[model samples]
Target: MTQISAGERDRADTLASRRDKFILPDGVIYLDGNSLGPVSHTAISRINHAVTHEWAAGLVRSWNSAGWMDLPITLGNRLAPLIGAPADTVIVTDTLTILIAKLLANALALRPDRHVIVTDSDNFHSDFYIADGVAAATRRDITVRRTTRAALAEALDDDVAVVLLTHVDYRTGELLDMADMSALVHAHGALMIWDLAHSTGAVPLHVHEHGADFAAGCGYKYLNGGPGAPAFAYVAPQWLDSLTNFLPGWLGHARPFDFEPTFEKAPGIRALVTSSPSVVGLSALAGALDVFEGISLDVLRRKSLALTDFFITEVEERLPGVFELVTPREHHRRASQVSWRHDEAYGIVQALIARGVIGDFRAPNIARFGFTPLYLSFRDVDVAVSHLVEVMHHREYDDPAFRQKNPVT
Candidate 1:
């Protein structure tokens, strides 16, 4: 009996119909959704409505009439279900870096008696930089620790105020068990703060169920809110009144319209909104999220695993020993993406892009491919592998043009 092709697998996929919602480029197989997701038709229409009707016609009155002032909260409430957060616990505002700094500060403030902030050594670089800056400014020690998933529990201790980690490894697409880690941090009397930058929209996350104290993630990647889309932050209900907002701004003020002399924080997650949110960006995000309204995350997660598994199998069977798989092999420990280590990973990624298969290259030697289930199918994975095979066979990656590194990659 002949084996079913990847294209056939995609044809039978229940989520395959979702690809119609996106506006992917013709002849391009986009595998970099973990970095930046392509814009959708809904987002485009929402932006147009916001611009032509809300902004141009309604003017300042649109802030009230079109619900511009409430976009952040509205979007947050809509996005809450995706992250397993309760209503009003998540606020869509600010960039990922700023949110991380604020969350770290609040975690430390909550545990003032504690002096150490523990984090993974392979955590996203910006997260580490922010941790370093916050630790320096607050006169606290930052402990960067690296451990395998099995040994993560050993890294926590009594002195730790908070344990910050990315739910998924950005480079290797490794998934960390949120519930287990959060439990470990709590056992050590440390608050658990998760950076969901890579996990949000790509995998199933039950932030509240896991008992995470705080969490933050970007909207541009799997959320498909376009570039510089506002990020979301989650503060557990238990810590709402206790955690201080050290970076408080006017919007977060309890009575901003009253123009009070003293700063007073608003209730719940609203208190985390330090500044006015970008209305247009929020509109785009709202539109992007509309695509997920009735979709089940379980189905999405299953398709994601299938997509990555197929890609891994194709690569290993067709191009043996050419690249080393850096991502975890276990289904539960893997995110929606796959990464490989190759000496000319940069050039190989460039060559893939040249063939209209848009994967990306990380620093040094990591080649990353992000499989966004919303718009990606097994057929796309099959085509991507075919191009990769050609690139490897013809030594296309060795081209001098691909060898020159771009500033962005």
Candidate 2:
């Protein structure tokens, strides 16, 4: 609980020299990358080229000549290493909700006799909502178990057809043991569909190595594909021929361009796709991923841990009793963010943003701060803590006018 010195902070800032790749605003310490990442310079340029050259000039030919059509699977291949999935097993496509529904239906098709879709009650709202739809559509029961890892293990019974869970808790940044949970699910004869929204870029993952049957995640959050970026899905290659596509649109047909009369599933990752790729967004994502071409997740994890640990310690030293930590203290059980429970979380978040230290607010009283190793520095974390201390001690967060609700928190 000690404040790091300005000299030490300066050294940390120097270490963040590589952050020049991002187009961050001056004097702003962005700590909401967990929700939507800041646009990178490379992403911007890539989008520009796609817009001007690929779309405007090339037009329809771009789909083949410019390789616009191959982006979904191509980008998926690029993303494979990040998620620890084999090549041709992942595909950049529709939103996580849509992908979840498709994968859930596909899994249900495989187990016609099973009626229960097991998931954690604390899983992200979208996942729960989709599970509800699956129940209604198939006349199957959805069993939501709101419990800890230990309890979850007990909940995975033979009746469970699929075990759905988020790799990291969106609210508290709590991480789950994928390997352990997969083993438990397999023992119960259930398939696992992991929501990698908070795990993909924040931590190292090995879906195939851990035997994950299915997975989905957002592109905008950690992949930095801008708002409404195309999400990706991972289906084990073993299910390539057997798994059915609930939304077997022309894009997923064996010969999409052929415009066949019957719905024939395409082979490999192509079969998982549902529609035309988002060229602009995918272009941006492809360029954004280039920033990590040779980067090691080990180095990224080390920096992430240092940043979160530094913020927590400095906050405790400067603003004790003002807020209570909601995120886990154990490094292994944590993600890339830190959260604190406070009565005036919304107002505090607004005040922090006004001061140019832009974090975010979650529901019910949680102030969240995300630290992206690519753009955030130790100095930024130090400055953010200083601003936080000022807001609390100077009563700057007591404003009644700044408490208006925002749609995109």
Q: What local lDDT does model 1 show for residue 205?
A: 85
Please give, for residues 1-409, the per-residue lDDT of candidate 1 as tens digits. Answer: 1157876887788877778889998999999999998888899999999999999999999978998878888898999999999998888999999999999999988888888888887888898899888888786565545555566677767778888899999999999989988988899999999999999999988999998999999999999999999999999999888756778788899888998888999887788888877989998998899888789999999989988988999899889999999999999999999999999999999999999999999988999999999898777888899999999999999999999989889
Instruction: Give the deviation of candidate 2 from the true structure as CA RMSD.
Output: 1.8
The alpha-carbon deviation from the true structure for residue 345 of candidate 1, after best TM-score superposition, in angstroms, is 0.5
lDDT values of the candidates? 0.89, 0.85
Candidate 2 residue-wise lDDT, 1-409, digit = tens: 4546645754755336658889999989999999999998889899999999999999999999889878999999999999999998989988889999988988877777777787887778888889888767775565544555568877766777888889999999998888888888889888889999998888989999998999999998988888989999999888877867877898888899898899999888788787888899899999888877777887788888888998888888788777899899998899999999998888888999999999888898999999898888777888899888888877777787667687876
TM-score of each: 0.97, 0.96
Model 1 RMSD in angstroms: 1.6
In candidate 1, stretches whose alpha carbon ends up further than 4 angstroms from where it belongs are 139-151
